[model samples]
Target: MHDAGDAVSLLRDGVVLLGFGLVFVLLFRRLGLGATLGYLVAGAVVGPHVLGLVGDAESKIGVAELGITLLLFIVGLELNPSRLWRMKQEIFGLGLLQVVLCGIAISAVVLFATHSSVAAALALGLPLALSSTAQVLPMLQSAGRMRTPFGERAFSILLFQDLSIVPLITIVAVMSRNPADANGPPGWLLFIYTVLAVGGLIVAGRFILRPLFRIIGNMGEREMFVFAGLFTVIASAAIMEALGLSTALGAFVAGVMLADSPYRHELEADVEPFRSILLGLFFLAIGMMLDLHAIAERPLFVAGMALALIATKALIIFGIGMAFRMPWRGALALGLLLSQGGEFGFVLFAQAQNALLIKPEAASLFGAIITLSMATTPFLMTITRRIRAQPVDSSDREGPVADGANALIVGYGRFGQTVAQMLIAQGIPVTLIDTDIEMIDVASGFGAKVYYGDGTRLDLLRQAGAAEAELIMFCTDGDQLSAELIDGVHESFPKAAIFVRAFDRRSLLKLKDAHVDGVVREVMESAVKMARLAMKSIGIDDSEINRSEEHYRARDKERLKAQYETGDLRAARDRIITQDARPDTGLGGGGK
Candidate 1:
């Protein structure tokens, strides 16, 4: 039923979009830049302003909007009520200050530079206040910092920004409304309507969605569950749109409603592909909308504005981190990680333009600035990391005096703390070494004799009396670092019995290769304990369970030793299974 020209246009758009998108992504990835930036460049290259290969930017915008909706939905899914409650300080305090301060600062700058009205400056500044969650979060995860103090704080602030979108969108809509319409409904009446609409949606979600999903899930068709989830989002978005509320806000509420459901992860898995593709399309559309001609005309001015915005955001974030008593290094890292403008800026600018809050030209210019800021994020974070890694003054390195302690502990984290506590309970004098100064200071407050230094440093280890210590234990969460430490210590202090806390089987093997005196897998003992419980629950006698556990442990140790010596885990595992399957031996029967 579609026109032949329209069909041709669709085909051409898909081919160009995918073709350019793939090449740019590969190239950007190779350069250590992210895929989001790659997609943006692809869109710009194929857009009418450049090659004129794709002129359907207007048509693509609707599809791109779906991406934002799904993104908000996923954000909602992540933010269960309990998590928000737990992170209230960072979300409300740090997040609020970041937005308000950044907004005011950027607004003043815009007003001074462009001589724009207060409302226009504010419209520009508020969206610029946000940092890119989609970009920064993945970068943090890849760097293995998500469990660190800095990462937790960063996540909390980003979460608050995502939640703020609901009110921000509402404010923009109210501002965009005509004065003539304002005369029709009193402000109090509108407030009541908004409250009632939100309450009604929550109620519907609690009652209607749970039962609907249960039924769909019972049917056991994965596609049906996906369909139902999409239906819920679209339907809720429609209702909110009709009620003069933000569709994203509505979709978010729907996601939270199902957050406690058993199918939450399933729903997330089902919707992820759609969310990712749509979000990419959204970024691509923004890319297509870039006014490259404007940039060419005033390159210095545009670049200056972008740099100014990043500087403002970084300063404000650093100030907030300092106010919260974070170390200077941590504050600097936080500032650098979140200096970029967010994906939400695109959404806000589009909405603002639609609401007549900003002109098309202003929107175009701001969009370009945000895109550039986002593209610079990876480099900024890398620089911050390098700065953080620089060696500190030796005078700052204070630690517990070795004092001839027989045992030296490296990495006073959760695992190390437990081991240290048990040793201390028996009146054992211990020297603990950790690189995290903050963590060491806190542990010191709890009467722990913790040292602040990189445990892997040979001089630091020597200072901690590693050469004289009877036992040296590596209890850090970092598997590679633990293996490296074991290797170094074994080479330098062969008399010290090195016992390592391996994170998994792979780490255990690595530690074994390092010729450590003992390698205790972090999870193996707990797994064995649980297996004992499982056996008892199935009517096995306690004595039998104990015998079985002992037999299994001995056999596993023998197998591990054989695998280490032969460097053939697969063959060792096959031989063990073959021995266990035989009926004659008591140990083999118990093993099976």
Candidate 2:
């Protein structure tokens, strides 16, 4: 009876917490502030310091920290050996420099300013060197630059940063001030454990995890994958916990082991929801745990520290990017994009507090500074848009040549495959571009080379030789194109005739003002063909079928024109004909 009562209480508490989270998250998202901030705000409002609607923040955080574990797992899944090797130069070279330099620089600043011990400065500053991957990746994706060179470079740094968390944890553990940590394994022994553990995970991934997933997949029981995914993460974390190691590291190892598996995406999809919810919960708990009074007492300290952190990291990163031969604008953009403190700072702050290297009040003050730094990113990018938008000097580099490819197809999906094949069937020189990593791998297996990048960007288009190509086909799905973009392409490459694949009427209407050579509705022709088949099965004569299709084609064209003119899909609804022109058209006009 007590257990049942406790369950009911838990449910009610969940409802209230989620209700607060949803409201604030939606509000913040609408205002262009990220969901992380929203969760923090909600948690603070409902916390003991404010409305006191919730309590036991420390207990809540212990559970919510699983979100961090799950997040690490997903990050590991992204680092497949092949992808890692492909971006090795950027990931290792530039990424290593960014983390090391920024970490050292920030540590020195913390050491000198706060007069903290070397260990304490490292615990605080190393984490600050990392940027918010969660915030930055979505921004890149939304801008359709996720596969661009600049975006990829940014991602490389972020990936290394995520990878750095493990060693950072080890460092924190090494500097533990708690007597409780004294009984733990020594540093060298811990390194051995790390190696043996990683090897075991890889072996498990190849034998145990893969076979289990395959069996579940073959059974077509998708729900089981979710169960299995959670089991894998929890089991790995449990293994580490039993060994008195970092549980998050265990989950990360599990993820990396499965990164190259066929079921990577499925596992990610299954586990993403739980990760998101728990992560939100984690932030909420952090918010509740935040020492508002500490921040209030040291407002000047908070503001000054935030500014110093952002400026120091940005300047350091900008120099590294330039040293790596990035264009000035690209380097500047990279700096600004990654200038903010990340969520992991909070995680490390807790670690520092636990290690007894930093007081809880110091952690809270730094946490507030990190949060403030995060809030400034969106505004900073908005202000520096023009400076980063400047064209790179062509004389500093050799220009991209089309290599005599007459047609450049922007997408290499099903639609693109057909178009490219038809063009190739006619013996036309062709180049294919795409953003889907899995699709690119599959296409490569079939001996088709698909260059990976967002095809919608004018800069990427130019880099792909859009200026020299005779035809540029945008066969990408959905409404990713715009008149302004089309005009830019046209203005840049006068010789290239542009053709676009419109997903629907709305997309077509949106592109109505663009001076493109052609626009093909993706499903219109196939839908018309199927409709004709239906008419033919019902015994309509060839002439009647032709007339019906022609009528629909004509009416649709007229309706589309009207709708496009008025900028409304509902403008020409009356033009749809319910009654046919054929009088008493009988089935087969007399049974064949």
Candidate 3:
């Protein structure tokens, strides 16, 4: 789709790539590795240097790079402006330290190891300082640690690394030995241009995006929203590309502007599929670009530099984490988690090659180093599990895991909001999921985070961390809870207590066979409370009021049990006064 293909060649490439990606991903996942590595291995096997099944990795990468932009946009949605500002210390302090120290140290290593000039070393080394955001984020999410203190810190560092790409590119350009490169804008001018571009994006997002979403949401067309979502991301990225800036950053800034939008989840859901496919393709292209012949010629040099890059970055980052007061275990884990060479290394290396600061052979060699280093991450992190598996204790010897969002609330309407707030007030971590984009927008305006999805689905719940959640509360506004759904959820996540908001006595009776901890009628208690208040307002004595309230509750309970037992509507029909009241429809009050 990146460009028009006239022959069967395009179809052939698609079949080959997707087919191979699917098989390898399944195989690797079954083997306890990861999809990223599988994609890489698949691409390598099919690349020109290997089976020669695919060529033109460069054009593929040009199209696939949109994946990186989309990735950053999603990452941006994870943090609102306030949260991002709060983490300024970590992003700027710890992150800046990590990139600069790792860059300098790796450059020195390259200079000594390769006997390269300072320019060549810097061109190669700085890119190695960056870690793979695409690789690390999913691992953290799958582990249910993406919202933890540790996860936030990791996210902050990655964010800064992304922002640093502009400067790294500028640095490479400044050191260019090619006469052609001399005509490009100088470093300072580029910096000013970057600032102007970012400012322009911020202004546009503030003035343009919300209104556009408002219109799209008003249209109430989900398909239209999908189109709008992609348009937003692509348009922002395109502007950055026009300015020769980080297209990913432009998408990110746009995301931050809408972080608190009620449509955040909808946008995320719409964009995620594209992000995954493109990101996979991006990895595949990186694999195809790897010059195995170049690496095969100097395997020792490539392997040694890979090891050295990982070690230097890991140690430097570990020290920096400790300086930021992270415990040794957390620090060590963080270091290893981010030690891999990033996708941007290829971009920067290409820049280096273009500038004549490094030869094409050098670029290919370092690209292999990055790929090799990336391959080691899953293994290293898998090993770090033992160090972090233990729950933190009073002694503080263990690195604490991400433990927030232990409760998943399935609605955010009026009823669901009260339930969530009460639980949150009690210090329970709650994840709010809703399907109503309008309601989500209102909640977001009040600074509440609500994800968009059909929470009844087991797969969606699992993605939201229902496996570890202590409670699964169904506060949806109707008889949306079914016995089968409840039973499925209970079976799927046995550890979590299940609760549902019953629409009426009939609904409660329907759930008698379901595995649930509790069920409450939507308006039963509030109706009773209103009755008590009405009695008091009419000057009824306290004892009489209490007696009347208890009698009504007792009779209602008795009727409910009788109807549930007999499975007949008439079972409790005679229990209620029929003089003035209409028939009970066995439905909720239809409250918003």
Best by TM-score: 1
- The lDDT values for all models are 0.81, 0.88, 0.83
Report clashes for each candidate as comma-separated counts. 0, 0, 1
As a TM-score, model 3 comes out at 0.64
Off by over 4 Å in 1: 1-12, 26-32, 177-192, 214-222, 259-266, 384-396, 421-427, 445-447, 456-459, 476-495, 501-515, 521-592
Candidate 3, residue 294: Cα displacement in angstroms equals 0.9
Assess every candidate by TM-score.
0.82, 0.76, 0.64
Arrange candidates by TM-score, highest first: which order? 1, 2, 3
Q: Which stretches of candidate 2 lie over 4 Å from their true place?
A: 1-9, 391-504, 507-519, 522-568, 571-592
Whichever of 1 and 2 has more TM-score, that candidate is 1
Q: 359-412, model 1: which lDDT tens digit per residue?
A: 877887888888789878788876667676635555766754658988888889
lDDT by residue (483-558, candidate 3, tens digit) is 8989999999999999999988778878878999999899998998998899889887787777777766776777
Q: What is the lDDT of candidate 2?
A: 0.88
